[model samples]
Target: MVELKSPAEVEAMARAGAVVAEALTAVAGLAEPGRTTADLDRVAADVLAAHGATSPFLNYHPRWASSPFPAVLCVSVNDAVVHGIPTDEVLADGDLVSVDFGAVLDGWCGDAARSFIVGTPRPADADLIAATDRALFAGITAVKPGNTLGDIGFAIAASVRRDGYGLLADHGGHGIGRTMHEAPHVPNEGRRGKGMKLRPGLVIAIEPMLIGDGTEDYVHDPDGWTLRTASGARAAHSEHTVAVTDDGARLLTL
Candidate 1:
């Protein structure tokens, strides 16, 4: 069933999103050379704890996973596109890190992700990150009542492909409100005018994962998580939870 949030519910979700934003900020600050992925997860955990928010990622037993997720945050590194489990692996200078997180506050949910370069700079990785973020916002710009899901997907895909980047064929966004994931999974690519019509009060996560060098091939790690690029290229991810409204998209996870 499609759950439409009233304006008041939307406001409440924004509160949850604010906590996510704070946690991401804290993670970014602590993500640097000599720090382990576990370090990043620890900071995010502290932020969620301080806010009295619960993590949707921690102990999450999605259908495809062999076991429950073990951490509060997903610390995907370099070629690993998404679902990279946080571990004791130390980060090095110029390594790309993507942190995906979700938080629930006051019975509402918010989810988001951000990719960044740690310590030293890598021009190509930075460019991919910028492009991935642009693709996410492009999808967000298309989130309005009367628009089709295909339109939003096309907007994101066009932006990514324009820069010679590709998206993960399987992973995409989803409806998010009282729960972290819900009906109507949104894709990164689709034909315009197809799919269900978007409506007001419908909130969804708009996330774009850019496969560097425009390849869709990825290797699934033995850990039953972590998707790495087959060619060993880097990847970038960006996301924001948004609410459809009479005006336009109201970003919850800003």
Candidate 2:
């Protein structure tokens, strides 16, 4: 069942979201040519620790996974779409880096992801990341009272598909509360004006994963989690946790 949050709960969630946003901003500043993905993960963990917040992704074992996740953050580089595990891999010029991080404060959770270019510009890489960022905002605009889940999905899909990017089918956004993932799974593609109706006090993470030059298929690496594009084309992901209020949508994860 979908649980509507109280004003107090939303306030606490906003606190959690602030930590997540600050963490992402810190990590983004640390991303540059020659930095290892693991180094970026360390930066995020240290920031969260300084804020007295805990990472929700650490050792998290979802039902589909064979084992618990072992990283504080997801560092997907280039062809990897989402759930990319941090490793000793070093960043190179023109590589597209996608960082997915989540933080929990006082049992409340906030999740977000961002894609960035390491050094010099690759036209395709820049364009792909920009498109995913736009798609994320398009999905966020649909989060309001009375709008169906499909409305959110359709807005996301329409934007990315128009740019000729592939919408990821295996992974999508979900309802987030005390836990990382919850009910009302939000897909990247759907028919508008359909599915569950949005209501006040509902919080959901709307993420868009767009593949620049591939199909919908993804391959899991040996690390047991990182998913990469099947066609080796670059991928980008952007996300934000948002809450529907009496007025409109308020971004919890800024």
- Per-residue CA lDDT of model 2 for 37-152, tens digit only, reads 99999999998999899989999998878888888899999999888888899999888999999999999999999999888979999999999999999998888898888999
Please write out the lDDT profile of model 1 over residues 171-254, one tens digit for every residue.
789999988999889999988988989999999998988988888888899999888988888998899999999999999988
Assess the local accuracy of residue 92 in candidate 2 as a C-alpha lDDT between 0 and 100: 91
Measured by TM-score, how close is model 2 to the native structure?
0.98
The regions of model 2 sitting more than 4 angstroms off are: none
Q: 133 in model 1: Cα distance from truth in Å?
A: 0.6
* TM-score of each predicted structure versus truth: 0.98, 0.98
Which residue pairs collide, candidate 1? Answer: none
Clash total of candidate 2: 0
Candidate 1 stretches greater than 4 Å from native: none
* Pairs of residues at least 3 apart in sequence or in different chains that clash in candidate 2: none
**lDDT (CA) for every model shown?**
0.92, 0.90
